[model samples]
Target chain A: MVRVAAHNIISPLGCTSQENFDKVVAGQSGIALRKKGELSDTDFQAALLNMEVLKDKISGIANAEAYTKLEQLCILSLNEVLDGVDVKSERTGFIFSTTKGNITEITNNPHAVDALLATTANKIANYFGFKSSPQVISNACISGLAAFVIGRRYIDAGKYDNVIILGADILSKFIVSGFQSFQSLSPEPCKPFDANRDGLTLGEGVASVVLSKADNTNKACVEVVSGAISNDANHISGPSRTGEGLYRAITRTVGANEEVDCICAHGTATPYNDDMESHAISRAGYETIPVSGLKGYFGHTLGAAGVIESIISILAMQNNVVIGTKGTVEQGVVAPVNVTKENIQKPVNGLLKLMSGFGGCNAAVYFKKHGE
Target chain B: MVAMLLFILKSMENNQIIKEVSIEHGKVLINQSEFFTGETSDLGPFLKSLYKQLNLKYNKYFKMDHLSKLGFLASEVLLLNEGIANETDEVAIILANASSSLHTDVKYQESIADIPSPSVFVYTLPNIVIGEISIRNKFYGEHMFFVQPSYNKEELLDYTTCLFNSTPCKYAIVGWVEVNRNGDYSAKLMLCQNKK
Candidate 1:
């Protein structure tokens, strides 16, 4: 089994996984209205990281100024999770996940070589003297979770003893304007799975997780049991009304007799996504499982959503508490799902992390506490 | 002993390359034979002419970005008479490219100078090509997009092998589809299935 050895999350809520989790348990959010003319002409609500603080945190890294903001954040998070791991070992693998890497570099010059996802990924991989070329996953929003799946496969194939997955995406005029054109951004903090939910609030974050094959017999850890990805085959930009792909993914990951403690849903707060997730959950016979969405706190951090939310949910499991869906006031989905409105103290062990993206792509991952 | 036997079975299943299609420099090749060739180097008109030549009824082809058009046409030509659409739900799509929609991303960025067009904005992501193919063919199986410096056959093959062994993936459309801002494009897709 692929075990998560260490992880780090750099979101607006906090810098580390524990910090972000503490803030979520206390019912705090990083989203706020901003008048950043660089990102948008008008005011917008999003969970934006403090660039100044980030620069200070990553200042000690060599030639940090040469890297883009997203790359800096990635370096920071990866550094935190490395923890003396032998990154240069031939058996260690690196995977970079991002929907758009250094996309802001193309705002003025579209021909910038650094704007290429592969180039940025290579730069990050080269920083720590990785022996092999990094595998890059740019599969839209599901990229992060897909990276984990690939990492696990590498370890399972005996090709690598450890794999580091780093996922990050930053907010820019390019991204904000595109979502604005789609009219997908919410004017206020997103209220996921709520009756009054209108749209998603875009956010920026960087997350890193280290998956190792080494057995840690002394401590409890989270094991990635299984993962499955499927396509809706419905529409490129719209959620499937039947949630066929999500249902298939969920069923493929979890067995009929397996008991799930909680579900971390990709609740973008867009009317169709939350409703479709509810349908998929109920269709998979998981309607009674307590479900919560971290978008209400993290504001839908695009590529980082999968890894960031997975880390938070796993932390919740370790704490033996199911964190509430922060902004969900009245659960208003088509299918009846046990949407948690407040933190519930429970014996959390198994977790089902779900995410769906713009490319009609949906992914589900099942994680169980080791030795549970 | 069981693991060794399973490994041998998987290796045996990986030998079959059912079909292959490649689009490069205004030429379309199906299974190493020239299917269509265009005289012009411009991508938009070349793709349009090829679409008409293929007698395709899908109108959405006109709306796709250059990257998506290349991938969509390659998959269309690759699976033309294959009848794999009957088992559409198990067909996986694993595509990689050097340029991740930078051709359209440049166009979308230019539109931001005026007004961001949602139509242009939606195609900025590289995986939109997979979405287009999935929509047209209704292949709801496993799908993923990778961005590599160049076409790495081993990576695609390794991942496809994993899917076939782990998931319900019976067939996969895998290859490299890339389009740059200068109208340069290349797409090489292979239809593969586990013979077992």
Candidate 2:
């Protein structure tokens, strides 16, 4: 079994997983409404990292100014997880997940070679001396969890014993403006699964995880039991109304009868996304499982969403509690689902993470708490 | 440790190369056999003519960006005749490339100053090609898009083998699809199934 040995999340809430977890448990939101004049001509609500603090953090790194903000965030998050571990061995593989890497640098110059995602992956991998060729996964919003599945599959296929998976994407004008064009950005803090929920608030962050064979790691870990991905084959931007893809992915990961203590969902707070997830859970016979969307706490972090949210879910299990779906007041979907509105204590031994992205892609991963 | 090393070596030997398809210089090659040829000068007209000649009826083809159109054309030429598209939950799509959605990115950037086009912006993601193909074929299966410096057959082989070995997927459509800054693009697809 492949297991998560270590993880780190660099976001607006904090720099480390524990810091973000503390804020989550306290119900303190990292989201705030940034004025439109600052990013664009339109005032929008989002969870943005304090650049002053990020600059202070960047000052400690060598030649940080030479790197792009996305690269800096990726390196910073990767550094936090690499402590006391050596990734220079040939057995260690590197995977970078993002929808758009260094895209902020592209700006209006669309032809720049530095805009390539592979360029960012190579720079980061070379910095850490990964002996194996670096791999980059860019499958829309599901990139993070898809990267996890890739890492696990690589290990199971005996390609690598350890893999370092890093995910990062920033809210640049290109990303924000595109979503705004779709009218998917919420003017207020998002309320996932809430009847009044309008749209999602964009967030930016970087998250990393070190996955190794269960027999090779002594650190407290969570075994990645199974993972599956399915497409809606319905629409590129809109999710399937029937939730066919997510339902199949969930059933493929956790058999129909398998007990799930908690569900960490990709509740972008968009009407279609939340409703689609609720229906999928009900169809899969997991409607009663505790479900929560952390978007209210940190907004939707894009490429980093899956990894950051999964790490937070692991933290929730470690604390023996299920984090509430922030900003949600009342249920909205046709199918009944137990959306956690308050921090509830529960034995979250078996946890499931679900994410659906543009391009009709849906991913579900099941993880079991490893030995104490 | 020795036993584990043996297993790794054994799995490496088990990987098999199936069918290969490459599209470049306005020529489509299925296993190096010339399937279609056109003027490489203009991608738009070339692709449109190819779609017409192939007699495809998916009208949504006209609405796709260059990236998705390229992938759609490649898959149609490679798998449409082999009955690969009709299978659901059995086949997987794994593609990789260097320049990700740069063509559409430029187009989207041009429109951002006045009114950003949601139609163009929706294709900003490179993986939308997978979505386009999925929608056309009704393939609700595992699909992934990667960004590599160039087309590396080894990485494709490893990842495809890993998927077939570890996931529920039995067949894989794998290779490279890229649209560079010059608006020049090429797609190479290989259809492989587990032999063991």
Candidate 3:
């Protein structure tokens, strides 16, 4: 069975999974409001990382200028997990996931940004001395979870024994303004699944996870059970009112057994997204399952959302505590769901991670505690 | 051991593709047959003419960027006869490219300076093309968009075979769709299925 060998998270919440998890469990939010003429022309609330902290960490590294902010976040996040492993082995592969890589570089030189994703992957692989060429998944917000699925498949297919997966995305004027143009950015901190919820708060972060064929005896590990992806085929930008795609994906991943103890949902705080997820969960007969919306803690980190959230969910499973939804005060969806507004102390076994994105893409992956 | 090895290899050979199509500047080819061609300057009109030729009624086609338009056109030509359009939910779509929507990205960046246009911003991501195709065809199957330095057919074959083996996917629409900064575009699409 494929297992999670190691995982690291670098976000506004913290630099390590333990630190981030502690902050999350404490119910502290990283999102805050910034006035116009700062990050954007209009006032917006988002969970932005401390640039001084990131810059200070990068200052000690050689040739730090060669890497962009997103790339630096990726390297810093992966560095913790890459140690004690031989990255130059052919049996090891590197996979990078992002919605936009070095997108901020576009204003400076559009030509260079043309190859930003591929070039960034190569740069990180070369830095780590990986023998194999890297793989990139840029499938909107589901990219991180998609990367995990692809990484596990590679190991199962015997193409590699271990895969290093890194997912990252940074905030920029281009991305923020684009979301503003879509009118999907919340003016204040996001309130996911709440009746008063308006929109999502954009966030920036990076995370890395190592998937290995061999079981890890020295560290905590989560088993990769099954994963599936489906599209709504309803609207390009809007989610299906029926939640058909997400229902199919959740059912396909967990099956009829419904062994899922808790779920980490893609609650973007948008009016349609939360409602769509509620319907999808109920249709899959998982309405009573404990669900947590982590967006209130980290906002929506785009490509990193899936990986970091998955990591958080796996940690919750290990600790046997359901993380609470940070910003919801009242239930919004018509369907019934046990939305966890406060941390639930119980024996957690199987965890479900779900995320959906603009392409009408919905992805669900099931994870179990090791030996379960 | 020898017998088992041969059996495994034999089973792998059964995963044969049914059809493949290629779309490049001013040209569209299916199974090595030239289906359409025109001057580069008229690429937009050419795609429009092709869309009209298909008798498709999807009005969203006009608003799509060049990359999505090319992917939509290629998928239309590939699945026109597959009988899986909007009916089957098991046909997976796996597409890869070298340049991940850089043409539209540049255009979108230009709009961000003035006022980010939602129309242009939505097309900034590479996977938007897959969404366009999925919406048009009503495909709710599995999909992924990858970025590679070049079209690696071996990786495509490996992953497609793996999906057919391990997942519920029966037929996979896989290939490369790319649009460089120069506005030049190429999409090599194929429809693969097991012989069972």
Where in model 2 is the C-alpha error above 4 Å?
Answer: A216-220, B1-15, B85-87
TM-score of each: 0.96, 0.97, 0.95
lDDT of 2 by residue, A1-372 (tens): 898889999989999999999999999888987877636678888888877887877877788877888888888899888875668776788989898787766675666767998988888887777888889888889999988888888888777888899988888888888999999988899999999999999998899999887774456678887888899999999998889999989988896556699999899999999999988999988878899899999898888988999999988888889998889998787789999999998778899999999999999999878556
Clashing pairs in 2: A36-A42, A36-A43
Clashes (N, CA, C under 3 Å) per candidate: 0, 2, 0
TM-score of chain A of 2: 0.97
Per-residue C-alpha lDDT of model 3 across residues B58-166, encoded as one tens digit per residue? 7788889989998998999999777874745778899999889788989988877687899888888899898888888778888999988889876777677767777
Task: Give the docking tier of candidate 2.
Answer: medium
DockQ of candidate 1 against the true complex:
0.61
In angstroms, the error of model 3 at B156 is 2.0
Interface RMSD list for the candidates: 2.4, 1.7, 2.9
Per-residue alpha-carbon lDDT of candidate 1 for residues A39-60, written as tens digits (9 for 90 to 100): 9988999999997777678888
Comparing 1 and 3 by DockQ, which wins? 1
Candidate 1 clashes between residue pairs 3 or more apart in a chain or in different chains: none
